[model samples]
Target: MTSYVEALEHLNQTVELHEKWDLEKISQIIARPNATNIQIVGTNGKGTTALFLQKILCAHGFNVGLFTSPHLVNVTERIRYNANCISANEFGKVYMELRDIFDEKQLSYFEKLMVVAAEFFCRHPVDFVIWEAGLGGRLDATTAIKNDIVLFTPIAKDHSEYLGDTLEQIAYEKFFVSQYAKKVYSSPQSQIVQNFMQKQAEIYCKEIFFIPQVSNFYIAETGTVFDIDNQKITIPMLGKHYAQNAALAWNAAQQTLKQKFSVEAGKQALENAAWPGRLQIVQRNADKYVFCCAHNMHSLQSDLEVLKVLREKDILSKNTGVIFAVTRNRPAQQHLQMISKIFPNIVVTAANAQHPIPQELQQQNYAIANEFGDAVRVLQKQGIHDYLIIGSIYLVGEAYKYLELEVRS
Candidate 1:
């Protein structure tokens, strides 16, 4: 038997799935007998929404399985029961066992992971399964499952290479997740998304529920507070945008369970929810640094809004420093313009070989560091009050490792 690390490395070398694969073949390999209730979430906040649903369902005494993608630290994070990450040994054992099946019928990296997770869920016997779309919904690997519920979060320009260039085009691709959904719940979206969703819902014959925007949310020095469905709760995470994300999660949970989920339980889970690499704080010496995997324009804009709000409340000082990096596929100029608009004093760094820091941005930014470690060192030496590390997940992952923060699940 090959070692788990070897198996993981081998899988990583395989190509990613473009769209859906053979569902019958996948089902034959991985039994999903207990996957009667499935929810497919798209775009930003999908992971958080899935986590919220998992907590609420578990609180209601239901066994829940959660499947998310592009894990920040470990592959085990892709699959979970309740709030716990699947054990490494268990993941290794499952992968090693499933390898023979993959060898028998060639599968992509994501395809293998999806099948492994499905098989694991069947063995675990969860009452409900929350599956996050890896990319666009229409042909995503997760679409192989016939979902009972479909959820959509705020959609913005992302994966332009594959999805599309315009918002309408992108929304069209994401709307594909609604095909298998019996009922749909979506956060209030733009006219483009709403119109597209309406058209899709009519064709698919699925009821659509729109979560209202959070009216009143305030951030304190320690955390944030907001009201959802008349239930006021506090979450340890920062940003008013997070309050909206939590509200969306709460509404989705209520809609799915057809019962009033405990506000206190949801609040507690939100407090305990450690979505690392998303506005996560890492400390080095006396400086407090925040790392976020904000790759696209929408997320970067949201993060900037939160930062502005934090600055106004005096939670973050103006002297904060920023270290930015992104993937080559992303629109680097647009992201840099947004960051420059929000943060004047910034330092740019290039990590991945494919996506080097653009010369234009490097010229605009006061400092440019070729390496991640050197970027951190240069930022620290500048005596900035607070630090923000933004861009690709790879950048945040590398920063997490350098800080000696827990990386493995």
Candidate 2:
């Protein structure tokens, strides 16, 4: 048998064939003997919300563990401590110990990682664990854990095949985490999601906290300011959507701590919170490049809004070239339509995988490239400035590697 690191590499090369619910054996292996405080974050803002909560809790003197999915560049980015990626040595050590158990039981890649993360936290004794669901909430491996608080970010149309078709059906699947949670907090979603969540709340007997939408948000070239829980706070991140994510994270942290969060603490934490590959700016040859992993149509729409704001403010220009790609699972037409609306000059390319690309796009643009490096080379050859890379996380990860930007510490 190969080492755990080698096994992880092999797993990444193959397609994920196991069901999400089949992770029960792995979960049982990592179950802590003590009552572990858990919060399962779902939907769009899972990474940001989890990072924010981890920062706030660490400030308040709590050991925090955050597990997020679809790492930007390295697999180690998926597991973090207060916004910092764990070291490769530490990861290898943990994997070596857990590999024995996994090999004995034959756990999947995701399942093996979950068990290692849980056992690492148990031994280290973290005060709270923020676990982001890999996919939809219903059968997600993270759902196996009993949660102290469950958080649902905006439920937009995404992962249609596995989750569902309509927004209501998708909302129902995400709400499944509430069953294992003591309480739940959700941002203001669509009417369908709100209605579904209400029904689920009643059945689960869990108190649901709704984060009201921010009526007034101020955005500038430097950052953004918004009222979260009636406290006006300035964050070092752009986008009106980020304010909503922060609000949800704030409410969840307050609920978990069972106290009014310090305004100064919340403000500082929000300012410091960082999640790479989402509206993240990279500088190359004195030009700005924005790399976002907007795989689904809804997420792409959000990124488009931010780009529009930037263009209006002269932060980004209309001539900015877009490096776009999509996975086989997503709706390519909808993604291309929405992206074309925002970015007039897009260079469509394929991510470094066997994912399908639309034939129509291939015929129209003739911009398809075999690998991420080739895609970057093609964009650079065109003398394009202010580049924006959008589409699947795999594309964003490859771009991150090419740019060599350090992951947030």
Candidate 3:
């Protein structure tokens, strides 16, 4: 029996997307398994939204399986059953059980894991399984499965290379995944994006429930608290967008009950649910640091706005220091300019994800580091008490690992 670690390493090393990307054939391995699958797609918000749904449904006493991408720490973080990680031992068991099928399908790194998740669900028998698309919905691997519901998070122009240049084009690619979805719940979006989604609902003949949001929510350094209708909910984390994600989950949960959703589970699930990397806090001695995965221009805007509010509430300080690194494709100058508007001096470092520091970023009044730790050391030496880091989730994940910080859920 190859160990789980060994098997995962082998699979990851062998599978390549350019060689094979047939999700339909890979999905067939677990196609006959008894499960009600829901696929959520968007440029942002899918991971948090999926996590919210998982916590809600699980709190409702239903067995739930959740699949999300770009794990901040362990790869096993990508798959969960009833709020518990599918253990490496079990993961290896399932992987070996279907190892031959995966080799035959020639699955990609992502597709390989998704299939494993599907198999894990098949073995455990869950009430519902939520799959978050790794990329654009219509063409992504998750759409290969026959899903019961599809949720659309707020779409944006992040992955311009594969999805499209404009928001409309990206919106179309993501919305089309729900063509066969019996029900669709979407978060509030830009008017143009909302209109496009409504058009998709009309074309697919599926009902679209636009989830209502509360903008003036509460955010404390400890966490954020807000309500969904009559349900008073609190998350042990930061970010205003999280409140919106929780609301989207409430709407989706209502669909499963076949009646008005229960606020009963809302309190417990919202309070306990752990979403890593988005406004995550790390405390080293007396110094406190906040790390958020605000990768793109739109996400940066949302993150900076939240920071401003936190500053108002004393959750953050005017003297806060931010460390940032962006993926190579996005306009580095614009991203750096946005940061400069909110933060005067920041640390710039090469991300473990391997995106080089942009020249424009170097031109700014920023400190450079050979690695993320060096950047943090620069702050630590200066006796900086507050550190706020934001950029790609990959960058955040790298920092998470380098710091050996254990993040909650």
- C-alpha lDDT values of all predictions: 0.74, 0.74, 0.80
TM-score attained by model 1: 0.91
lDDT of 2 at 258: 73
lDDT of 1 by residue, 1-409 (tens): 2466866876777765554355556555655546655655556777766766676677777788888887766788888987688887788888888887888877877778888888888888688888888787766767778677788888877888788988888888888778777777888788878888888788877778888888778877666677876777766567776677777777777665564566667666666655677766666677787877878877787777877777787666777888888776677777877877767677788855546876666767368888678887887787775878888887887677667688532
lDDT of each residue in 65-110, candidate 3, tens digit only: 9988978777788889986887888888888877787677777778
Ordered list by TM-score, greatest first: 3, 2, 1
Estimated TM-score for each candidate: 0.91, 0.92, 0.92
At residue 318, what lDDT does model 1 achieve? 77
List the lowest-lDDT window of 10 residues for candidate 3: 15-24
List model 2 lDDT by residue over 28-139, tens digit each: 7776524345655556877777777777777777778888787777777877665466677777777776666776776667766777677667666677788888788777
| Model 2, position 246: C-alpha lDDT score | 84
- Model 2 / residue 115 / CA error / Å: 1.3
Off by over 4 Å in 1: 17-30, 352-366, 407-409
